[model samples]
Target chain A: MSDLLERLRGRGWRLTAQRRVIAEVLDGEHVHYTADEVHALAVARLPEISRASVYNTLGELVALGEVLEVTTEGGRAKRYDPNAHRPHQHLVCSGCGTMRDVHLVTDPMGALPEGERFGFTVSGVTVTYYGRCPECGSRA
Target chain B: MSDLLERLRGRGWRLTAQRRVIAEVLDGEHVHYTADEVHALAVARLPEISRASVYNTLGELVALGEVLEVTTEGGRAKRYDPNAHRPHQHLVCSGCGTMRDVHLVTDPMGALPEGERFGFTVSGVTVTYYGRCPECGSRA
Candidate 1:
C-alpha cells in the first residue's frame, strides 16, 4: 500500500480496490497529474476504472486534504499534486508547463506587511516560480 | 481613453467599438474579470457584442502581454488581470473568491536557492496569498 493509502486507512477510510489503485498511482515525488491523466493511468493498471470514479476519488482526496489541486496556467487542466504533506512551492517551465517541487528558504507570508492585509486574516500562501527548463531552453 | 486602449492604439492595434468597450471594462486597479464578466460588461456598452469577440480580444491582449490571466482555484473560471504593467502579487479571499492586488516587500526569487533550481532558468514568480476577507470572516 502507498503512504496515501496507509494514511487514508488510518483515518478509517474504506479501501475499495479502485480507490487503492488510484492512491497508488498518486504516490510519488513531484507527481502532478490532471484528471484525464490520472484516469488514463488508472485504466492502464485496473482496466475497469471509469473516468467518473477517478474524478470522484480525486475530489475526495482533495477535500480530505490528502491531495492538493494545482493550476499552473489559466484555461489549462488542473493538476493533482500528492505532495500535500511536504512544505514546498512550485517551479513551472514556461515552455512546456512542466512543474517541479521547490523548497524556499524564506517565509513568503512575512513579506506581506500588516498594511497590505486589507483587513483580511491571511492564512496561507503559494509562490509559483515560472521559467524555461533546460530542455525547453536548449530546444529554443 | 483607458490606459490599455492608449497602449493598444500606440501599438497600431485597430480599435473597434467592441474592442474599445472591452478594454475600458478591463482598465482599473485590481480589476480581474473573467471572459463571461467582460462580455457582460461590454454588452452593456455595446449591445451587439458577442461572447466570441470578448474571448478573442482577451486572447489577443494576453498574447500581446498587456493583460495577465489568473486562476485562483482549480475548476474555476480564469480571471483576466489587467495589472500586467505593475509588479505585484495577489491576495485572494477564500470564501468569496475576491482578489486584491498586493505588493510584496522581499524578492521572492532570492528565496529559491541555487540548489533548488533543478536546471530551470527561473525568470518570474507570483506569490498568491489566500484568506477570508472581513465580510466572509464576519459571516463565519
Candidate 2:
C-alpha cells in the first residue's frame, strides 16, 4: 500500500477502486505527472479507469493538500506531485522537462533579507533548479 | 520610452499601434500579468485591440527572448514578465497571487552539492518566496 493511499484512508477518505489505483500510480519519490499522464498510468493499472475519474481524484488529493500541482515550465501542462509530505524542491531538465526531487543544503526562505521583503509578511519559499540531465548533457 | 519598447525597436520589431500599446502596458520593473490581464490593460489603452493579437504578440516577445512567461502559482494562469533582462526571482502572495521581483543575496545554484545533483548538470535556479501581502495580512 502506498503512503498516499494509507494517508487517504487514515483521513476517512473512501477509496474506490478508481481512487486507489490513481493513488498507487502516484506512489514514489520524484513522481510528477500531468493529469493526462496520470490518466494513462491509471488506465494501465485498471483498464476501466476513466480520464475524468483520474482528474477528479487528482483534484481531490490536491484540495486535501495530499498532492501538489506543479507547473515546472511556462506554457506547459501542470504536473501533479505526490510527495507532498516531504520538504524538498525540484530539479527540472530544460531540454526534456524531466524533474526530480532534490533536497537543498540551505532553506531559501532564510536567505531573504528583511530589506528585500518589500513590506510583505514572508512565509515560505520554492526553489527550482534548472539543468540538463545526464542523458541530455551527453547528447548535447 | 520604455526599455522594452526601445529594445524591440532596436531589434527592428515592428511597432504597430496595437503592439506599441501592449508593450507599453508591459513596461515596468515588476510587471507580471496573465494574458487576460494583459489584454484587459491593452484594451484600456487601445479599445480596438483583440485578445488574439495580445496573445500572439506575447508569444512573439517570448520567442524573441524579450519577455518571460512566469507561473507564480501552481495550476494558475501564467504571467508574462517584461523584465526578462534582469536576473531575479519572484516573491508571490499566497493569498492573492500578487507577485513581485525579489533579489537574493546568495546564488542558489552554488549551494547545490555535486553529490546531490543526481547526475544532472545544473545550470540555473529559480527561487520563489511565498507570503501574504499587506492587504491580505491586514484582512487576516
Candidate 3:
C-alpha cells in the first residue's frame, strides 16, 4: 500500500499518520469498509486517530480518485472500495450487508434506451444487485 | 392513490392521520421525497406531524413494499418513490438531486452471468443513472 501512498504523495497529498493507516486498512482486493469500519481499523493501528481525521482522510482519498465511495440501498452507512481503477459493479447481501465486487462482460449503460434519456445529459450508471450471502441464504 | 390506501386499509393498516397525510404527500405518479421533504409537506397539511412520525410512516411503507427507498451516491437523504406497483429504475440529477422514475426495456438482473454469482443467492437489482437535469445541464 506504500505504492498507493507514494503515488498520492507524488500528487501532493500530505500523508499524515492517520491517512497512512487508513490507506493500509483499505488496501486489499475486494475490500469495502464503511467509515466506521475504517475508523475502527485505523484506531487499532494509530490508537490516537480521531474519527474526524479518518472521515476527512477518506473523503480526500475519494476526491482524489484513490478510493471509490459506494452507497448501497436502504441502509445508511456508505462503504468505500479501494478498487477505483477497476470498472465494476457491486452485489450486496440484503440480510447481512456484505458487499462483493463483481464485473460483467456486458455494460449496463446500454440497457437504457435513447428514448428514455429524458433530456438529462446522462453521465454514468450504477447497478447494485441485491442478494443473500451463502451464510445468510442457508438460514433462510 | 386512494387505491393504494384502500389496498393498505384492506390489509388492515391502522390508518392514523399522520400515516394518511404521509400517504397523500407520496401518492402522485413520479413522486419521490426524502423524509425531511415528506415531513415538510406533511406539516403544511397537518401542521403538527412529528418528524419521527414521518420517518416511521415511511419505514412502514417500505416494509410493506408500498414504497421503494432509493439511495444514490453522495446523498445522505434517501428518497422514496411510491410507484412501487410497477417495476422501474431511476435517473438522478447529480447537480440538483432531482429523481425521475423510469422503466428500461432490459432487466438489469439478467446482466449478471451465473459464473459471477459469487455464492450469493441473488434476489433483485436497482440501477441508478446519474446525470445533470435540464437546468443543471444548461448551467454547466
Candidate 4:
C-alpha cells in the first residue's frame, strides 16, 4: 500500500523500483514466499530485479518489523510473511510447501507453567505444526 | 555412548573418525552447538574433521532419530542437540545463545481448537521463548 511505502520512506529507506516490486509481491492474504521465489515473482514484473535486491529488501522489511521470517524444519530457505500486524501460527503442507495461517484461539503462552520460567522473562511464543495436507493424504 | 554408536552403525552408517568426533562433541546434558561450533569442538579432538563431515554427520544423526536440529527465531545456523528422548521446548537466551529445556506441563497440541486443524494431522510442535539472560539483563 502507499501508506507502507510512505512509512518506509519516513524510515529513510530508499524507495527504489526493486523494493517496490518486492513489497507489492509480499502484500496479500496467506502470502508466504521465499527470497528466491520473491525474486522470481518480482522479476516477472520488473525484469531487471536482482536476487540480491530481493534478499536485501526482505531483510530490511523483517528488521523494520513489517515482515516475519519463518525457517521451517530441515533448515530450508527462509520464507517471508507480511502479516506481522496479527499474531498467528502456520500450518505447512509438507508435500507442496503450501503454508496457511492458523490463529490460535488458546494462548500458547498461558500453558507455560510458572515453574519453568528459569528467571528469564518470556517475551513471545510461536508454534508450527507440520503434516501432510488433505490432497497429499488422499494420495497416500 | 558405545550403544549409540552401535545403533547408528546398525542403521548402515559408516563409523568414521569424523563422525565419532561429531557425536562426542554433541554428547552431554543440555548441549546445543551450531554446525561451526560443532566443527570447532570436533577438530579439537580429531584434528582432521571437515565442516562438510560435521554437516554430513549431523544430517545423518537427525535422519537416524538420534539427534534433533533446532532453528531458533529467525533463520540462523541450525543447532544440534543430543537429547532426543525427551519431549521439551527451548528457552533460548537471545544474548548468549544459551538454551535450556523446559517441559510444558500442559499439552500444547491439545490446546489447539478443533476448527483450527485446517484438515492436517499435526505431527509435532516446538515452542521457543526468546529473552535476555541474567547476565545480559544486568548489563542492560
Candidate 5:
C-alpha cells in the first residue's frame, strides 16, 4: 500500500484523503470491486467521498497501470482490480458473483498458429470462464 | 442470407424490413460491425430504420444465439458478428479495427489446472488479441 502511494505521489497525483482511502480499500489480495462497491466501502472510512471521486480515482489507477477494468456481459458496471502487474485470468462464480484469480505459466496465445492469426500481430489474450461454485452447485 | 432469414423465422422472430436490412448488412465473410455501424448500413438500404430498432434487433439476435457481441478495449463500440454458433476467438487489428476469426482446437479452460480453478465451473472462454494488421505493419 505504501509502495502504491509512493508511486502515485511520484506520478504527481495529489495525496488527498479520498485517494488514500480508495487506495487502502483497493489494497490486499484477491480484491476486485466495482466502482460503486468501492464507493460504498470508501464511504465507510471517509464519509465525504463522492461517487464521482471514486470513479475518477479508479479510472486514474487504471490509466496508471495500477489497476485493471473487468467488463462482463449485460453491460454490468465495470469492476476494478488493483492487481494489474500480474498475469492472471478470472474464474467468476455464476451463482454468487465471486471472482478468483488463476495463474498459468503456459502462454495461451502461443497456441494460435501464425497461419490462423490472419495478419494481425498478436499481443495479449484474456480468458474468463463463468460457472457455479461448489456452494452454489450444492444448493442447486 | 436467405438461410439466416429462414432460421430466424423458425425462431419466431418477426420478418420486418428493418430486420432484413440488418441481416443483409451482417452478411459476407469477416464482418464485425457495431449496432450503430449496422444501423448506418441498414439505413443505406432502408432509410426509415430507427437506431432503437437496430439495437433491439441486435439484442434479440444475440439472445437467440445467432450473433456474438464483442466488447473490447479502447471503449470501441460493441461489435456484432453473425457467426455465433461457431467456436472461435478474435484477432483484432489495432490500426483499422478489423477483426478476423481464429479457431483453436485446444480447450482454453483446460489451460487452467483444477487447483487454479477455485471451485468455479467454467463454461466458456473468449480470447481477443490485438495487433497491427499486415497493411498497417507494412505502412509503419
Candidate 6:
C-alpha cells in the first residue's frame, strides 16, 4: 500500500517509521485487525514500536477516513477494517466473532423513511449482520 | 418491568438488591443508558451499589437476553438499550450520543441475498442511523 503512504503525504501526514509499518500491516482487502493485533504485528516488524504510537497512528488513519473502525460487539476491542475500494457492510460470526465484508444489493439508507430521519443531517448508516459462521455452526 | 423480573425469576436468576435496582433503572421503553449513567442513576436510588455490581448486573442481563448492549460508535462506551416488548433499531445522535428507538418498515434480513449468507445461519441485524439531533443541529 505504498500508494496509501503517498496519498497520506499529499494530506501532509508526517511520515514515520512506526506509522509506515502500521499502515503496511493494515493494507490489503478484508484485513480487519484490532488495536492489540495491529500493535503486536507492528512490534514484530519493528522492535521499537510503542503501544502509544500504534494507537496514535490508528487514530490518525481513522480520522483521515483511510481506515474504517468496525465495532461489532459490545464493549469489546474494535476491529479496524481496511476500507476497500467500495462501500460494504459486515457479517459477523456471533460464536467466534469472525467478520467478513459483504455488499448488500439493497441500499440501507432507503430503509429509513423520511419520517424517521429525526431532523438531523444524516451522515449515513451502519449495518452489522450477526450469525454463526460455518465452522462455529458445525462445531455445535 | 415487573414482568421482566418475573421472567428472570422464572429463569432462576437470583434477585438481589443491586440487580433489582439496576433492573428498575432499565425498566422502561426507549431506555438507553451507559454503564456510568446506569451506575449514577442506581446510586441515586439505592446509594450503596458498587460499579462492579452495576457491570455484573448489566452483563448478566445481556447474557440472559433481558437487555441489549448497543455499541453504536467505535471504541466508545457501550450503551445498554432496555429491550422493549417489540424489537426496534436505534437512531443515534453523532454529536451528543443520544439514541432513540425506531422501527424499520423494511425487513433487514431480506436485504442480504442468499449468496452473501456465507454458509452461516443468520441470526439478526442491527441498524444504527446517525446524525445531529435537533438541539445539536440548532446549536451548530
Q: What would the per-residue lDDT of candidate 3 be over residues B1-140, giving only the tens digit for each residue?
A: 78888999999998899988999999787798999999999999999899999989899999999999989998888889999889999999988888888888888888889888889999899999999888888564
TM-score of each: 0.95, 0.91, 0.96, 0.89, 0.89, 0.93
Indicate the fraction of true inter-chain contacts that candidate 4 also forms: 0.67
Clashing pairs in 1: none
Alpha carbon lDDT at A75, candidate 1: 25
Per model, kept true contacts as a fraction are 0.88, 0.81, 0.88, 0.67, 0.66, 0.79
Model 6, A1-140: lDDT tens digits are 79999999999989999999999999877788999999999999998999999888888888888888888764289888877457899999888888888889899888888887777677778999998899998454
Off by over 4 Å in 2: A1-3, A138-140, B1-3, B138-140
Best model number under DockQ:
1
lDDT for each residue of candidate 6 in B111-136, tens digit (9 for 90 to 100)? 88989888989888999887889889
lDDT of each: 0.88, 0.84, 0.89, 0.83, 0.83, 0.86
Index of the highest-TM-score prediction: 3
- Which parts of model 5 have CA positions greater than 4 angstroms off? A138-140, B134-140
Q: Worst ten-residue run, lDDT, model 6 chain B?
A: B73-82
- What interface RMSD do all candidates show, one decimal each? 0.9, 1.2, 0.9, 1.4, 1.9, 1.1
**Candidate 1, A106: how far from true, in Å?**
0.1
Q: How displaced is residue A21 in candidate 3, in Å? A: 1.2
All candidates in order of TM-score, best leading: 3, 1, 6, 2, 5, 4
User: lDDT tens digits, residues B1-140, model 4?
Assistant: 56789888887878888888888888888898999999999888988778898888889889888999998875388888889988888888877778888888778777667688788877777777777667668444
**Poorest stretch of ten by lDDT in candidate 6 chain A:** A73-82
Off by over 4 Å in 3: A138-140, B138-140
